[model samples]
Target: MRVLIAGAHGQVGHELLRFAPDGCEVVALGSAELDITNAQQVAKVVERLRPQLIINAAAYTAVDKAESEPERAWAVNRDGIAHLAQTAERLGIPIFHISTDYVFAGDASEPYRETDPTGPTGVYGASKLGGELELVANCSEHIILRTSWVFGAHGNNFVKTMLRLGREREELGVVADQRGCPTSAASIARALWALAVQYREHGSLQWGLYHFSGTPACTWHEFALEIFRQAHALSLLERVPLVRAICTADYPTPATRPAWSVLDCAKLRETLGIAQADWREELAQVLRELA
Candidate 1:
């Protein structure tokens, strides 16, 4: 099978490249090589490669910055995805695009389900939601995976940022009100590869949006404290600070984040027969690698 991965240099993309699945010829492309926002470039690449599967990991991920740069965010997140989906349709290929839990308004009492209505609080979320709509509309064979709080070995994720900051500061302030799962990019890559293989074997199955993340949910403060604790235990840090809890209003950003962005993984678990790893266990693996 021929698989073409966009944003191959990103956190999840890099991990996917490192953990390339068996029995597949993987062609990875970074933004410099193939700017997804350029429809002509996308069309040219897809036309030449004619890949059976296209897994898009490219995105404009600056959450707070997106508020001031909505156009830029939409270019890559919304319009870029439309281009990929359209090109996939032209080649009669399937696309596996990554999305986010920010599609929800963050007011849900429980985990957000696939069938729930989306009310994005910021431009970033709205752009991703736009991408989802485009993918569903433009292509019949596509998989939209909505995940949250993604972290791993590569990229500027919260896990890495906290590790760096914890070393310099005696105390840290993290937003405690916002609650969601910390999804490992490695796990997300594995799930994407699995879904790609399954789609190849069973083309008749339904193709649409699905939510996947770590099993247990946690606040940003709790997550930070856990990271510091594990880092200290592993000797990765000299001392772990008392990570103070703060509300969303305490530290304001240009983007309005959803208060709760936890996604329900019941459909993903049941349909794919996949189970999510615990958040701490996932974080431990990441830290071990960093160490």
Candidate 2:
């Protein structure tokens, strides 16, 4: 089966290229090669490739900056996805669109489920929600996977930022009030590849919105502490900095983050027989790679 992946240079996209199943033809394209916002280019490329499946990992993911640049966020997150979904539907190909956990209001006491009501608090979340709606409306053969707090060996992520800060400063403040699971891009890539292979073999899919994140939700403060712990163990850090736990009110940002953005992955597990990875294990691997 031929698989075309957009946003090939991103964390999850890069992992997808590395972990994709053998014997499958994979065409990975970064933004410079094929911008999803360009409708004509998307149509032309999809037509030329005629891939059996398309995985869209492209997104405008600057959460804080999105507050100041709503247009750019909407263009890539919503309109760009619309173009891909439309083109995929036209060519009778299935699409796997990556979404975020921000679509929820973060008010839920428990983990957010796939059927939860969406109330995005910021432009980034709203635009991603728009992208989800666009995909649902445009294509029937599409699976929208909503993940949270993604990190990996490649790209700019919270793990990398914390590592850099840990190396530079004596102390750092992390918001303890916010909570979510930290998913590994490698795990997400493997799961998506499994779904793609299943679809190709069976010629059918249980397509719809699903949630998949790492096991054991944690706050930014806790996550930072773990990073320091692992880095220190790996001898990657000369001096482990102090991570002070602070409330969300202590540090203000352009965008308001979800106070509780953990997602329940039971649906994906039940449907696809996929299990969530232990984030601590993944974190150790990531730290070792950095080391």
User: Which number leads on TM-score?
Assistant: 2
Q: What local lDDT does model 2 show for residue 195?
A: 93
Q: Write the per-residue lDDT of candidate 1 for residues 185-225, one digit (tens) a residue.
A: 99899888888778778864457889999868999999999
Candidate 2 residue 232 C-alpha distance from true site, Å: 0.3
TM-score of each: 0.98, 0.99
Query: Clashes in model 2: which pairs?
Result: none
Can you tell me which runs of candidate 2 are displaced by over 4 Å?
A: none
Give candidate 1 misplaced runs (Cα > 4 Å).
none
Pairing residues by index, what is the TM-score of model 1?
0.98
Candidate 2: residue 24 lDDT (0-100): 88
Candidate 2 Cα deviation (angstroms), residue 84: 0.6
Task: Enumerate residue pairs that collide in model 1.
Answer: none
Give per-residue lDDT, candidate 2, residue 203: 98
